[model samples]
Target: MSEVQFACSTEETHQVGKPQAPSFTGPFTTEGGLTAITLSSPSEMDQWIGEWIELAQQTEFCNAFYEPTFFQAAVKNLASQEDWQVVLIKEDAEDKLIGFFPFVRGRGPARLSELSLWKSKLSFLTSPLIRSGSEQQVFKLLLKHLRTMQPRVDLVELPMTLAEGRVHQELHRLIRDNLLTTYHYDHYSRAILTEGHDYDELLTENIGRHHFREYRRQLRRMNNLGQVEFRTNEDPEYGECWADWFLELELKSWKGEGGSALKQDPQQEEFFRELVTSRTRAGGVEMLGMFLDGEPVAMLCTLVSQKGCFEYKIAFDQEYKKYSPGMLVQLHKMQRFLESKRSPWVDSCAVPNHPMINRLWSERRSIEHMVVSLGRPWANIVLGAMPLLRSLKRTFRKPKR
Candidate 1:
C-alpha cells in the first residue's frame, strides 16, 4: 500500500483485487548494500520476468513456475491469502536485479513467520531465481535482511527443491556463519533427461531390448484395435482439443475416482486452463495424445519454460493398460523431442522412484524438503521436533508380525 517503500520497486496502485506493488524505496538493505523488494501481488513483478529468465539461463536450477505467465496463473487460480511474495534482490550500487525469489510467506508454530518457495501442490520445483555464480552472495543478502523483518520472522522452508542444486549448497555454506540451523528432509524423487543419446537407443539400453520389443508388439496390437495414432498439439492456433481429451482420459483413471481430477478441483482446473490457453499460441504449451480409432487412450501435457519443457500432468485410460498406451505415446513424443533437441533437456517432473518415469528416464534430479531457523526459539523447537515426530511415525508403522 505504501507508494514509496522497499528498495527495488516503485509502487503503483493497479486495484486488481490483490495487494498492491511494493515500492523500492532503497530501505531494505543487506551486506554489500544489497536491497530487496517484496510485493504481495504477482503483477508487480511482471516487468522483471525478462531479467529473471536471463539470470536463470546461467543457473543449474530452474522451475517453470517462476515464469511470469505460469506464476501469475497459479496465484490467480490458487488462493493462498498468506502465501505469495514476488521478491526481487539487487545491489544498491547499480540497482541491477541479482535475484528473484517468488515465495509464500508461511505461518509456522508459535506464530513465527516463514519464507517458503513451494506454495501450491502444483509447484514441482521450488528453486529461486539467481545467477549460478552469485548464489552465495544472494543467499547472504536474503538471510541478513530476513533477520531484520518486523514482527520477527523465522523458518525458511523450500519444499520440493533440488537438493544438489546451487541453492541448497549455498544455504549450507551460509549456515556456518548465520544464526540458522538447517535440516533437510528427503521428500520426493524426480526424473531428468539424459543427453547425447537417441531416445530409442536409451530405451533399449535402459529398459532392455526385450521390453522395447514388447512395447512395439503392443503398439502393433493396438493398431489392430483401431487406427492408432500419436498426436501433439503445439501450434499456437490449436484450440482446447488437447485439454478436453486429457480431462476425459484422466477422469477414467484412479485420480478421477479419488476426486483429484482437474474438473473435480476448481483451482487446479482454473490454473490448467489459463496455463494452456494463454500459452498455446506462443508454443509455450505442448499436449500429446494417444488414440485408438480416434478414441483417447492416453494424454500428456507440459508447460514449456525457458529451461525446457516440463511435464505438467499426465493420464491414461486404465482400460487400455494392456497396450501400455501412455508409455507408447510418451515414447513416441520423446523420440521426436530427442531429434528436435528443443531445449537440451526434458524434466520428467515425476516423483522419484515413480514406477513409470524413473524406469524410463534413467536419470535423477535431486530434490529435498528443508527448513531453516530464523534464530527464533519457537522456530528452533519446531525444526528440532519435526524430525523426531517423523521418526516416531515411522516407528509406529513398523509391522510387528
Candidate 2:
C-alpha cells in the first residue's frame, strides 16, 4: 500500500470546532497517476450522474445493474438501509471520470475485515462501470485507493463478475503485476443472446427439433383456450401500471407462494417500481408479455442501455404453467431482440444452468465471486489458508453415511 495523504484546501478541511464536510474527500492520486474520490452518500452521486452514465455507455462490459438509473434505484431502495461507499476513479491529466465502484464494508463481529461490491439479491451482474479502454489502469487505482482507507480491510470480494470480460481479464493482469493473492468461487455461466445470430438458427440450435416442435404444440394448446399473443411494451405512459401488472402476475407464481417474490417485501417492491419508472422515462425499459386473449399470463422486464440489455425480471401466472407461458415469452424476447439493432446483446441474468433460459439460449456468460488479498500481512495469511479452510468446511459438512 502506498502512503497517500488526504489533501484538501484549508477551507475544505475540517476544523476542531467547525462542522465537517459531507464525507466527501480526495482526488487521491497514486504514483501511477490515476486519481480516486470517495462519495459517502448516494445523494452525492447526483453530482456525478453525467460522468457515471457516460462511463456506463462506453464500458466494454455491459452490466445494466450498474448503469446510472438502476444503480441509483438500488442505492435508494435497497442498499441505503446499510453502510456503503462509491469510489470514482479519474485520469489525473484530463480529470476524466473513468471508473465507478460502489461497495459495502463488512460489518458486525467476525466482520471478516473485507469490502464487497454492493449488490442486493435482486441484482445479477457485479461488473463496475469503467471506461472502455482504461480498465487496467482504473482497476489498479481502485485497488490502491481501497488499500489506503481507514480501518483497513483484509480482502476485497467482487461478486458476480462477468468471467473473461475485459474487466475480469484486467483483474487477472493486475493480480500478476501486483503479486496479489486471489481466490475464486461460485463460478458458473448463465444464458445470453448475442446480437447478429439469426433467431431461427439460435432457437433451433438451442431448444432442439423435439423441443421446438413441443413449443409449437404448447402454443397451439394455449390458442385453443384463447387468442394467444406476445406483446412488447416500451411506452413510458404504461410504465407504472405495467410494472404493477408484472408484480401482481409474479405474485401468482411459485415465488410468491414461497415468499421470495419482489412484491413479498415492501422495500424490494418499491425498488422495482422506482427502477421501472425511472428507466421507462429514459426510454430504457421494455416489458414483454404473453397474453391470453388480451390478458397477460406471463411477463418479463428488460432494462436497456447503449452497451446492451439485461433480462431483469420475469414472472408467469401459475395457472398457465403447464402451457409454459414463461418459456413462450422468452422465445418472443429472443426473436424481438434479434430483430432490433439497438444493443449488442441481452443478458438473461438467470442463475447458472437455469432450466428454462439455458434451454432457450445456448450462448453463455460466465460469472464468478472473486476474493483478493489487499497486500496486508493479515490478508495474505487469510488468503493463503482459504483453500485449506474450505476443504475442512466441506469435510465437516459431509453427511454421515
Q: What are the clashing pairs of model 1? A: 6-25, 7-24, 7-26, 9-24, 189-352, 236-281
lDDT of each: 0.74, 0.80
lDDT of 1 by residue, 1-401 (tens): 12234443433434467443334433265567766666666666666666655665666656677766677788788756754565678765644577887767768645668777745668777677787778888987777666765545688777777677677788788987765676677666578784467777899988999999999999999989889887788566664666677877888987998989987887888787777777787677888888788888988887775567788888999898888888888788778778877676778887667897787787776777877897777778788887788899998996979
TM-score attained by model 1:
0.86
Which regions of candidate 1 are displaced past 4 Å?
1-27, 30-33, 47-50, 53-58, 92-94, 109-111, 396-401
What CA RMSD would you report for each candidate?
Answer: 4.9, 4.8
Measured by lDDT, the strongest candidate is: 2
Per-prediction TM-score, please?
0.86, 0.90
Query: What lDDT does candidate 1 reach at residue 75?
Result: 79
lDDT of 2 by residue, 144-174 (tens): 7778776677788888888877888898899
